[model samples]
Target: MALMKLATTWERFILKDLTKFGRYAKVELTPPSPGELGQVVKGAGGFVKDALTFKWAQATVKEATVNTIVIAEIACWFFIGECIGKGSLVGYQV
Candidate 1:
């Protein structure tokens, strides 16, 4: 019984060390392909179109204008942020 217990303890220690080593492994996220980028742009354009239509049909012009402007601004900033992130990634690769 004592020998069996010793063997089990050693096995647990080895597995713990392996788990620690696996935690330090590197991970990467590659850039999207041209086709994928095109699809994303198309989707964004569709969203802008929908927002415009909704704004035009609203009962209050003031609220509609504000919402439309906010949506457009957010979409522009999202694309700009993506470009900046890609630029930084390129620098990291070099």
Candidate 2:
């Protein structure tokens, strides 16, 4: 009975969270329209310009540390996904 109650509580929490994110996902997952594509290109250009300046250099040590950790997390997740896809950690089995 305790186990069932725990599972029910867990399910409610998950469903609530999923409902919140589903709204965001619906909007974010849609393909960008042509006008949005131009905006994206402009944004990319601005990002490149910022990267070339002292903007990044001005980041505090804490901000730089957080950014490095986030990037490392992304890289680790990509490698994990590749291993999952290949069905082996070391390499694809023949």
Candidate 3:
């Protein structure tokens, strides 16, 4: 149990760092316009709304921004679940 806890802790730390790094990298790579940033935020908001209201599972970002948005949405959900006393779980379709 102790080892499992330690591993989970380490994994979270790594994920946090990687997320920060990715955000910084994206900012440096292409500074998005206000509209683009708004779109991303809107996309994430829609995702959260759907997730909460209907248990919907949808990717927040479109194909072009998949990597960045997916990472960001996962981080957002992690923080949200931590705050709300729930665990993040997604269903798998066969």
Candidate 4:
């Protein structure tokens, strides 16, 4: 049982080390308050709506941005599906 516990701890520590993106770590920004974090999260939720229906916002939208929306929607849907049932993923070390 002691050996099993050591192995498990080693594996978790190695994974946490491996997944880090060191560039972002160097930035010196204060952590968001809980309320600010919630608002930021809520703002991010608009990404899907903007991607799906943003062309409607303009009288004359560019063709490239319109095309990007279709691609974004497909990619976001795949990410959503992947997130539904999975446990841990590349989201570690956050």
Compose the digit string of candidate 1's lDDT tens values, residues 4-89: 99889978998788777677543224577899899999999997997788855754888778878999999999978877877863
Clash list (residue pairs), candidate 3: none
lDDT of 3: 0.79
TM agreement with the true structure for every prediction? 0.32, 0.58, 0.30, 0.28
Candidate 3, 1-41: lDDT as tens digits: 99999999988998889999999998799878999999999
- As a TM-score, model 3 comes out at 0.30
Which prediction has more favorable TM-score, 1 or 4?
1
Residue-level lDDT of model 2, residues 2-92, one tens digit each, is 9999999988998889998999999999999999999999999998998989688999999999999999999999999999999998988
1-94 per-residue lDDT for model 4 (tens digits) = 9999998998889767755644456453558789989988887777667768874466456766876898899999988777664645556344
Candidate 1 Cα outliers beyond 4 Å, as residue runs: 1-56, 88-94
RMSD of each: 11.4, 7.7, 15.0, 10.0
Q: Judging by TM-score, tell me the better candidate of 1 and 2.
A: 2
Ranking by TM-score: 2, 1, 3, 4
TM-score of predicted model 2?
0.58
The number of clashing residue pairs in each candidate reads 0, 0, 0, 0
Per-candidate local distance difference test: 0.78, 0.94, 0.79, 0.73
